[model samples]
Target: MQERGALLEVVVLHPRDVPGADEGGADRLFLVNDIESGGLSPEPGTVSRLCRETEIPVRVMLRLNDGLTTTGGELSRLVGLAEDYLSVGAEGLAFGFLDSDLEIDVEVCGYLADRLPGVPWTFHRAIDSALETDRAWRQVRHLPGVDAVLSAGSVRGLDAGCDELVERAAADPEVARLLMAGGGLRGEHVPWLARAGVRQFHVGSTVRPGGSWTKAYVDAAHVRSWRMLVDDAVDHELARRTTPYT
Candidate 1:
């Protein structure tokens, strides 16, 4: 499977790190307030700050809590919050949900996307948690307003699910617009992941100085190195696709 140029998303834990993320040449900023629960939406103030200060795209996660079961009043509240974030100028939204059976809640997810009208959305990491990965994509990939799916391919992570990703990418290059490879993705892994059909690379922990574990800062220098590697790999892949084969 040949790879296309991927959009790089760098996670920013703090609003203050926004500039550093941009300086590192990030294509998008994953503004997060809570990482332990996957991630949560940033404050409206933070969203406003990023909007005012940065030129790059910024997406705020709409996760209300840590768990996957969002429903009833909680779901309603999330809807209102989505409007608030959009009103305050978030470039896009990211959120996830699952039914009691641990599947993609298409009815619920469809409503969420429909409410936003024209805004771009990401179906978050919930897809990785789904029991039926194939079924999940079949339903949600083409859902209105969903521009991407932030997944590691399977619950285990990119490396474990590379084969599934490779297959999916081959079946539908348009699936979720992009099968963004996140979770444990790094520079060295890019070439193989690309060959496995993954086109987009996302790094949260990797964007930090000590790989988002030993440190809590978005190291611009570290990001620059990753940026170089990602751009080079994407370019090389595109070149490969264009070269005439024997």
Candidate 2:
């Protein structure tokens, strides 16, 4: 398989890194905190600072409820915070809400569209929590302003039957173009995903030596190493496709 355009994207899962972050060696920066238990709503300062200093476009993902459910007022507050993030410099936001049956709560998403400016928003893997993956996908993608849906495709993970994820991404060009493959993703598995026509990627462990709470900071070495592999893969994939054979 051959790569087309720039398909690789790196998601920054560390909070401390956000304050002093530079676009020194990344094609894109996904701003978030606490990858261990999904992610939390970013601190106001972290989001604001990244927007101020970085040239790289910022993708903000807010994990509502810190791993629980959010009430209407809570969602409203989150929207306010997201608006502040966009005003500062964020180019997009990632989030998801589930109904009782685990399907995407379209009502909540609609409220978000009303709250934030019309920037890009990705429905995070919370979609995978749906009891019905395909139905959940259908409902989420149809939400207004939802530009992308991030999923591992199946409950298993991105590595399993990834072809389905690529197909879903290619199915609706109008509603969704960014097909982010995540969950148990690593450098070694990128090629397989690329071959399956996946463009956007989400990775963390490969970027860190060992994620530790005691570190009190993002590991620069891990960031460089993970980014290098991603860039190399993007280059190799693109070269394979665009290089004309004599």
Candidate 3:
């Protein structure tokens, strides 16, 4: 496996968004439910199918709601679902835990992390919802067994403060990192983010139907388009960086 902050790696949203998702150049698959609320949580069967079939590593993210804060029962349910997914071949689990105050619940996250062995775990974007983003980063960086945080850095906009996020991750050694730059990311912005020190990225629109409320969802050609965009961006960067200057 490549190091955490390698260079411009893509993580597709849901399996459905990218039908032939496994074949794409994405480094990871964040399995979720494509509900009206924005996040995607797949059924056990769906996760199993992707894990059993896909060659790429599969990571399943469980959310308590459209935003942060999860209940004990909900956390348990996620753990159970994670077990099921793991048994069927899932490679990682993506989730976040927050206390009643809505801050990162290191204790609770540690509990869930303990339950999951071998499979890597992502703190998810719940970090972006904290009352304070800087503090959230500090707390999550200390969480045990956390593989990375799938965050856009600031809740205001994924692209707005990417430099801050990248700098924070780069400075923290205790925190293994993956700056999952998401939201408003396109073929054009891919290079900008790469140069900004963001190595990992998340893209969904290219795989799913665009618009907040499509009412009528259809083809997910966006996934293929996104894959192409990221692939091209990586190829372009590789060539540009490797060229010999005369």
Among all candidates shown, the one with the greatest lDDT? 1
Off by over 4 Å in 1: 1-4, 213-215
RMSD of 2: 3.7
**What lDDT does model 3 reach?**
0.64
lDDT ranking from best candidate downward: 1, 2, 3
Clash count list over all predictions: 0, 0, 9
Backbone steric clashes in candidate 2, count: 0
Deviation of model 3 at 20, angstroms = 3.4
Model 3 residue runs over 4 Å out of place are: 1-18, 166-176, 208-246
| Candidate 3: clashing pairs of residues | 32-40, 32-41, 33-40, 33-41, 34-40, 206-222, 206-223, 207-222, 207-223
Candidates in descending TM-score order? 1, 2, 3
TM-score of 1: 0.91
Clashing pairs in 1: none
- Compose the digit string of candidate 3's lDDT tens values, residues 1-246: 332233223344344433445444456677777544646456888887767656667888677577667777887887888888888877888888667787888887888887876567778777777877778778877666676677766776566656666566556534324556675565565665555445566765444444432332223355456656665665665566668998
TM-score of each: 0.91, 0.79, 0.77
Clashing residue pairs in candidate 2 are none
lDDT values, one for every candidate: 0.77, 0.67, 0.64
- Give the per-residue lDDT of model 2 (tens digit) for 1-246: 333443334566544554322432555677777666677777878888766666777788766565535687788788788878888888888888887767778887778876765677878887777878778767876787876677787668766746666566556543224567777676666665564445666654445446543454445566566566656766776677778999
